[model samples]
Target: MLNTACLRIHISARTTTTSRISKLANSASLNTVAARCSHHAAHYDGPSPTIAIIGSGPAGFYTAQKVMRELKGTKVDMYEQLPVPFGLVRFGVAPDHPEVKNCQDTFGDVAASPEYTFIGNVNLGHDLPLPLLAKHYDAIVFAYGASKDRKLGLEGEYKPHIYSARAFVGWYNGLPEYRNLNPDLTAGDTAVVVGQGNVALDVARTLLSKLEHLKKTDITEYAIQALSQSTIRHVHVVGRRGPMQAAFTIKEVRELLQLDDVNFSPIPDELFPNDLKSLPRPRRRLMELLKKGSPPKEGASKSWSLDFLLSPKSLTWSSSDSDKLEGVLFSKTKLEQADSPESKVTNTDETTLIPTSTLFRSIGYKSEAIPGMQELGADFDDQKGTIRHDGIGRVVSLDTREWDKASLYCSGWVKRGPTGVIASTMTDAFQTAEAIVEDWKKTFDSRRPVRAGWKGVQAEAQALNLSLRPVHWSNWQNIDQVEKAVGVERGKPREKFGNVDDMLKASGASG
Candidate 1:
């Protein structure tokens, strides 16, 4: 979905191991950053520019952190639709992966700054007009990650027993939107996951994992109960291409392979290239693992497989019961170049039907432009499922000049497509933050009025009598304390509130 085309209307516009050490090192330099900001504050006499960030996810916080460090006396107001902050960390991330959420500690540090503000329980496009928000800030940063998932576009996709990977993940992770998903995992022992990404692996792993293991994680109590009754044991992770073209990483594959008592179905040796020794280290290792597979445990009751080169053609329903899913119909595909990772795949005449009652589509995630984006001279590329932007992050539209009005920028999945890991997101956010700081410095003028930031937005909302109760940083801290306390009693990290009302009440913003 990378828009490589140089549009005149433009309106607009990572590594794993070394990444972890760099983040830890970055955390230790907070004091130096603060000292540097103080020096900048002492020398600069211009009016402090206020920025409005449209999300409270990793991207928003990281962008805020960098902007505050680079620009002295800057005020950042981060807005979150949910009462709680930390978008993906709180909801999208798997409950078992607590280490991946260490970024929250950095976000916590950013939230502690006096110049930073968190406005939660506020839906931007619905609760407040986008143009009204724009009037209050010198720049607007859109960091809201993807909210929707890509569909398989096959027939019978909307039928029961079929679920998107995004919805399933949300249901297990306690995201309020999908709290009541309650998928019917007891239908059958076999589940077909249609995708080769890490999310597909996550679904397979969760289905195969013991309920007791999931209980120790922050997965909701209801989810744990539902999983306890899951009859799903054999997961077939299907993909449209060969193993070399899989979107999943070695870490995810290894995790699935290491699941206790869950055996892995060895991939066909023909699927991999003969000259594995010449492949890149990561791919070679992954191919080797797929070839080697996990040892069969004596008590193994569950199993999974990495099924490749099969495109989902349609869903098969039970002959006797039209409502019940029977299996998935897949068309066999042939890769143009078996050795190449980017090989094109073509469907062959042969088709295979894998009998299963459940299916999970794990294709990818998608982002949409917030409502009223047109008012700010921004446009959403519906086809691309992203806010149209210059490759760097500056929002572009045919209606507005490049430098006439308040700057509009985007980051993370909204700026680019929804891809990459947390570390990659951090890097993307930092780049956007740099662009913002540079633009602000170049445009700062004595005659220009200082932005009112949140105060202005509050005044506007009051004038309109919107009856909004914005959740502040202190409120979120109270909510955090409550969640953590509950988690302590539950023997888990944190039991997140699964609905907006509960979250609002906990934050004391129910009014």
Candidate 2:
């Protein structure tokens, strides 16, 4: 259901290789061709401006592509905490939605340019202090993305069988951090997901999908085994608001409805507008589809639903086991006006209990302050889950004393809260690049002193004893092939290596 709008976004945001002795000979030829190409780029032909853009996700890559295309003598060195790149596209996209991952092709094109460089496996503010970047690069773009998840604060939310959507998505998608989640899906047949976002739907779809559907995807082998043994049958995606205010896109909902042998319980018509023509095109289509629902096939084996206008209060425990989840207690909510997007909700006297043994908290994702942010004179807004910015992408200090026009900035989830899709993220990133390019031109002509790109940064890193072992584009290409070869042997699209050491070893990344 990922439609043409997403493809158009790709068109709007439209923006690597080999080999030793034989590799060295190939390397030289490639270098010669690259040098010739760089000289001809028309924009990046002169001494390049050093720009350090942290994080290699869509934001960082798209920003780099736009900057390199718009500015002459501009070189970008992308820094990633992991040896692999394409942050969420690699670890957050649902395994079955291979179409959404198509943006990787555009990112790949950006990385192939001579003006662009890949520096992976180096954690900013940790492996090297953030201030160290100031001395080497002319500009620093923080795009590390959200590293933490928002919690439900419910009393028993941490008990066994309760997981955040990020962890669940990460577990199946092979994120190194959540590889050992090993959620107990056999506890019961019913599961409650406390959110109505696309992620919640993805979790529902994965749980209810046939094992055959998952086996052919790029999902981790360990997750494949875990899901194959799941006892899950029903999924309830609960939300604080009614259908009109739901955050999920029509494509995600349509995909779930179309799943083989999976049943979608219809959404109540009372929650929707009386006249469908009153709603926008997207919402009207979505509401109509939801009201019609997917009637289960003759012998459908599993089912899911959109449980709306319910505010989760707490997780109830089973009588026999205190640590195991049994149900979610929700307070019924009433809409203030209902048909408008600005409608608000308030708790009502009614209450409902959903029986379940497994739970997922998918309210939303929150971004954390990158370490060493304060010493650089920029502060992270704890309340907003973002860095303090001018709302366009510039990191500014509200406190007059700390302000230095710091030339420090951020984009993507770290700058704005994590919300949009790849296409949306691309739009956000391109805007950030515009801001950056505008600033760079003015700064380049000013007395900001002179600097070398990554070369200068590497020299400073060595002097600072940062102990950084970075992976380049070539290394990623090698590790990529290794992962694909492994996948081919197992009959899947690709099998991800879920550990940092394994990827570095596969890349043969040297100090």
Candidate 3:
């Protein structure tokens, strides 16, 4: 998950393109997009570029959107590991934030394009080798976002009550990978979430929000049952840095504050600078909100607080219940400059402990190189957890001679080291699309033969006797309809199938 602080900059820079793209998405007409691409078509007499994008998340779809809008007759084959699409929008987003998922509608419109093909349930590295895609497409775009979460690296951090925010979010949102996470919210009444990101806040809020509020969203049924029985009433969002350096946005903080019957504990006045007037607008507003706190509610059984300048040291188990988490040990830290957001901090010998029954680590996300990326001459920066690129989305090939020939590129978190929000991803993806278009036009004479795209890939798979059941766009629609129909029965937005088999069955792809 990324921060939304850079959203305004992206929106302002691409206002015209976005407005037109919005109109095209609303219309969902091939002719409108074709008309927009006519001028570009006149310049390229060669066959339209056939691109294979890995992942069906916002980055992939937005990249496909811009390329398709600019390159007439271009074909994009999107590969997704699951039977369903919309990677993060479907699995990572908090169920309560439905507004953030409006981008899915645009993704749906992108799938409606005849030039776009959604090949779901196809794992490129496992189901089909990465090298095999090169024979069938002119270019490959890696848009798969970070799939791993960062850890606190503290002693006894992998105990039963400890979980990553990713796993918990996936468990509730119906992601197959973490469907069985089954977090024991009933373990105790207090839980500590280690991080100050929006995800940490999401976990805190979910533990405290009214069941009736979550019931109307697309959260899984099993998750709802577990949450209904949750005994958690207090949450401590712990961070290594002070409030000025916290990663959470003002909107998420404000939402948590406004939850009914949920009280927020006030921050110590000394933690903040004496004169807040010197801080930037966003920081000023957030600090003010933290200072003001939430209104007192009568009979408020749930409360949460921000605990800062505490670096996690170890996890303690309960004395009575040895298997259960008792609390987290933290070493106190002091910032070199209290008022500066980017100030460095040094840990002090003094330590404090916050008693708890559960813990969630939401430090950040990390991207790993897909197995067999080396087969395509692609590189991954292990330290940075990002695909090796030229800082502009073009994957840096091991052989410079094969750079232009390989036509390999990347976008989103995998390219930019998992940081910015959806708006930032869109901007990053659009820039990649422009780069591809420019390269295609520049290297037209040396371009490879016209590739058959998915058609060629399907033939190769059949020849290789690979066991693959691809869920096309129509198949996803069937699954979508069934989920929505089931939602109507439950009086909620939608009840996602808990596993891949159910999704495959709903998509009519089950053998």
Candidate 4:
């Protein structure tokens, strides 16, 4: 459990002293200062530019960081629906892969800055409407990631036992939405995860990790208990295309191969050629792992198998139970060469079936249209399932020759169509900030100063009947302290509060 002593202390009293520096100078210094002043004044004039970033994820924090760094004296506020911050890093990354979550440290640093204010438990389109934010802030950046999952679009895809990789990963990672979602893992010894990607690996690893092994991590108590009772033995990671086309990274594949008691085997040599060419480096490494077999002296309880060049056609039930999944029917496929008929590779479509109880599809992620956004004259691509943006992450109107609106922008998965690692997301955010700065430089005179503080904003929100219980930055530090204390009491890592109410209560928020 997390040590309570290690958690940082929380300070609740607000200080009137201005810790932040003001770049606003008198009009007399306007000779050369006018140019630089013009660039910086858009964010500082009248009331500080009330910029609201709509997510608390990596993209949102990084965007806030870059914007505040570039635009002097900007009162940048970030809103998140979750009680806590660090979206995927806190709730999506595998528990064992703590190193990947170092991004949270960077986010913590950004959140601590006086220039940034975090308002948690505020859903953008719910309690806070996009239109309201548009009217309130000079610029509103939507960094809400793709919260929805992609479907298989296959027969029986909606089978009760068949889960979405997003939900499965969320369940193990203690996402509040899926914390209570404990699927029947003991139904069958064999399991199948459709679609080859890092998400698929994450699902498989969570299903395979021993309860004891997970105890040391920050996995929720409920998740730990549920996984402790899982009876899964074999996990088959199936992909529609050949290994070369799989989306999983080399590092993830290596990690999976390193797991004890998990054995990885590929298709027969006749199915895959020894001289397979033009394969990506990650796929090649996966092939090498397959040939070498399991590592020496590993766990003896569970194993994972890899199947490529197969597409799920149907999900067949073995028993009469409507709530349980039985098996999956698959269609075998072979690679085809684009050049000539006599080429080494030729198209081959063979049919087959694999038996399993659990199935997870990890194809990809898609964004959903926010309510009132379209009503506010926002353009979105229905086919692409993302907001329509220019090359620089500006929301473009169909009638306008270019994006002239100063209030609307985006970052993260929503900006770039749900791809790339956290590092890549940071770079993408900086680019988006650059675009915001350029646009501000072009149109500086129109923006007005914002006059609102935490107290004033809360009072206004209350007047509007909005249940605005914001988890201030210091409040998070309190929750962090209490959670770690609870974890230490239980001799485990941090134990998250099951719901928002508990989190707020722990943070000393008044009823």
Candidate 5:
């Protein structure tokens, strides 16, 4: 029924298609076998590498920046649990310190790369098994920061008025997890912070800062209201060490000493190094500043002190109401060797109690393993509270005692532990990026293409019938614009959305 010429042409086209499919399907028999974008990832013969970065914090962004620069054909897919990016910058950083967040500009530049993909609101372990991601990505970098807080194991730590510094900071910065954390700031006139870290100073400063000053920053409206109604008039930043071994940086200490109407109680001279000149330059300067304590300000109604060489013993409750926190009991401690960071402390026979209605523990942060990490041949250090890794950030396998992947890597707090400021985090992240590049080049095959990262993951998720609502970079920008617009009306730099659902809605993504 068909013309001979037309039938012949159709038959030739079909033959060409069959020949091409057979060639592609059997290409593994030739030279290289690579899988990508299939139910398990399809095989390909190209040479570009694909990478997945599992956090949107400063460390993650910095690592991605370095990797992208070093590997021209590398693709980076960043994952975040929050609808927004800039993990700590947006949540952990104090709102008043906008200068520290300048690094977000660099992150913005990195996100703008065509090879970069921002996958926000998709929790790596919660939304999909971590091992499943390993199938798609040639490498996975864990930068999901410390999500838990360290505890002192003291009695009554979970008492009502006692708060962890992490929660307090999150509450003020509008982190969705703590948005509804309505801390009863009006319940106390005196507060005790049981650590001498920078975070402790931040907490103390926020409680003491003038509302007019706070209003100029992007601190949440909710936090502003709670602080404005606060009855706190005294703060004690206590530590189980001397001023010489204090954890606070000089810049933060200076800020506290300079607050407008706040009175600073002088640190004991005995706690400082006797031969100040013999100390390091930074310590010398800090010691000198401490010695020249802020001149007692006239009409200074509120005050704070750097109480040293004391460990928290227990919380004291009101005699009249067992549930009401009345004060804190602390054991006096003596340093094993004074004026040294490594010095240990021993509890003395003496104990002291300071009456107050509130307490904040600023000890430190703890990083825990995601549920599915072990399935990926990676193990979290239960004792250390970190992912098991080489000092340089290569995730390690306990059984094989080798690089967990030659592929799995880590950066930031998850790699090193929760310490240091953003600058330190950037440096560590760069080191991890370099390690990843080094490992990749060492094991790379010229003929084989890297497995598709997000592309393959998308396919797998679809195949598994999982709904993943990812907020891409463009979506985050829309959310940013909305936040800024709202901030303008409130006369603040940028009022953040304190809830996750609202953040997704603003970004035009369904939560």
Candidate 6:
């Protein structure tokens, strides 16, 4: 069990220096007057359009950028529940995939713009009611990405040794919320991870990388220690569907083949349908790699299996005092073509059990509706767990095509129904922003302006008794300084502040 008291909040709050503000104003003055006028006109013309973005993810940041750029003088405030910004980009993407994180630089640029204010460490439903925000801002965009994991819904899933792949990944990646979730790696030599997506591959690879070959990477110190002490020798990655129906991409599949001690087993031709065999060369190469079963020559231990056509039915635990995960019950499955090109799999209903000490399920993600918005007549899809929006991304009531008076919007995984890579999310964000701009144009002069400027907003926020940790540009610079300094102490590239309060204190924002 982890101690919740150890988790600390890092607050970065300090006013910008006079020199910096003056420099920004001076530089901003050089831009064309037409551009400036057009920007501010979107907010001041109708009823001062106060825009609130409920997330700080890629989609939220991109949407904010588009709105600020096109709407000019709009009052846009972005709220993030985390003390730090960048949702999955910071905590979900693997540390090795740093290039994908370049998106953060772009997000940082948007956050720094004068047109926006980043209110970090504020939970939407908890800190401020959604309806209240809607009333305060002309528009509210719920860009909060799916944080919960999909369950296997099997018997005995509540067993202690079982964990959701989402939590495990977050734990290894040093997410403050899940940093202390240390699984007992010493209990068993072998483990099983269910699902066949990029996330599944990531978990498998991270588990396999426990060998000495990957010790140099920037894995969390605690994760590194736990993995180094792991007793497991093999991991079986099980997928219900055949190779052709697998959700994992070619790149991630190939990366798994390169692991030092692991082996990649190629699927037999009989397992794939005739149509799938006729796929283009790139996909053929992926299938070809899936067919070879040669173990690597080096590493701490050998043996990892990729088992297909297996659906987990239950997680069985040992009756002994150890009370550990004893095995998983599964049913064999077969795939059949659907009406469309995508195929679907059905379990034969026959069952078998495989003994294992640990299990991880990585089905998918689901979105939760923000609280207090239901009264405003917000509609949600029960099957998809997504907010129902029209082509322009406006939240709509179930009864009609008209917009809900609350004018709620969404982007990222929540907007497009939890599918796509970061690049796809960027495209979705751009589309949502375009729609918001279009909506603004129609109601530009009709909205009422609130008496709040930056100063008044600051005063109101301060009066709320919220932590005034300013996380100003200088504070970020200080954080960078401390991170680099600590990284040097450990002989790594950069050591992150695992504890949030320590980071704030080191940045001089917390006394």
Best lDDT goes to which candidate? 3
Ranking by lDDT: 3, 1, 5, 2, 4, 6
Candidate 6: where is the Cα deviation over 4 Å?
1-49, 210-213, 274-277, 292-300, 338-341, 397-406, 450-477, 507-511
Over 4 Å off, model 4: 1-48, 270-287, 295-299, 338-349, 397-406, 446-460
Instruction: Indicate the worst ten consecutive residues by lDDT in candidate 6.
Output: 5-14
Enumerate residue pairs that collide in model 1.
11-396, 11-397, 12-389, 12-390, 12-396, 13-389, 13-390
Query: Candidate 4 lDDT, tens digit per residue, 1-511?
Result: 2111111110001001111101212222212221232233244332235577878887798787777767767767888888788887677777777655655665787787787888887776777555655545567777887778878787767767788888877787767788667777878898898877778887888888766778887778887877878888889998766654556655567777777666666456654445544544434565665566555545477788778777777778756676567788888766674122122333246677888878888877777878778755567666566677886778753245233233677887787676665545665677777777766665555434453534455666777888766777888888989988988887766887767778888887554
Which tens-of-lDDT digit does each residue in 1-511 have in candidate 1? 1111100000000112233323433443433332332223224455567899999987798789888877878999999998889987777767777766666777888899999999998898888877888767888999998887888887888989999888998898888999888899999999999988777877888888888888888888888888889898899999999988887877778889899989888788888899899998878998998888888888899999989999999888888988799998999999999889889999999999999999998887778878888888887888777888878888853235444356888998798877766655666787888777767776777766668899989998999988787999999998889988999999998888888888878887647
**Candidate 3 or 4, higher lDDT?**
3
Which candidate do you rate higher for TM-score, 3 or 6?
A: 3
Q: What is the C-alpha RMSD of each candidate to the true structure, in Å?
A: 6.1, 8.3, 5.1, 9.9, 15.9, 9.7
TM-score for candidate 4: 0.83
Give the Cα lDDT of each candidate: 0.80, 0.78, 0.81, 0.67, 0.79, 0.65
TM-score of each: 0.91, 0.89, 0.91, 0.83, 0.88, 0.83
Instruction: Give residue 466's error in model 3 in angstroms.
Output: 1.1
**For model 5, what is the alpha-carbon lDDT of residue 285?**
91
Summed backbone clashes in each candidate are 7, 4, 0, 6, 5, 21
Clashing residue pairs in candidate 2, if any?
Answer: 19-23, 20-23, 20-24, 43-72
Which tens-of-lDDT digit does each residue in 388-504 have in candidate 6?
788557775324423323356778767766666554455567677777777767644433455343345456656776444544444555776777677677655456666667656
Model 6 lDDT on a 0 to 1 scale: 0.65
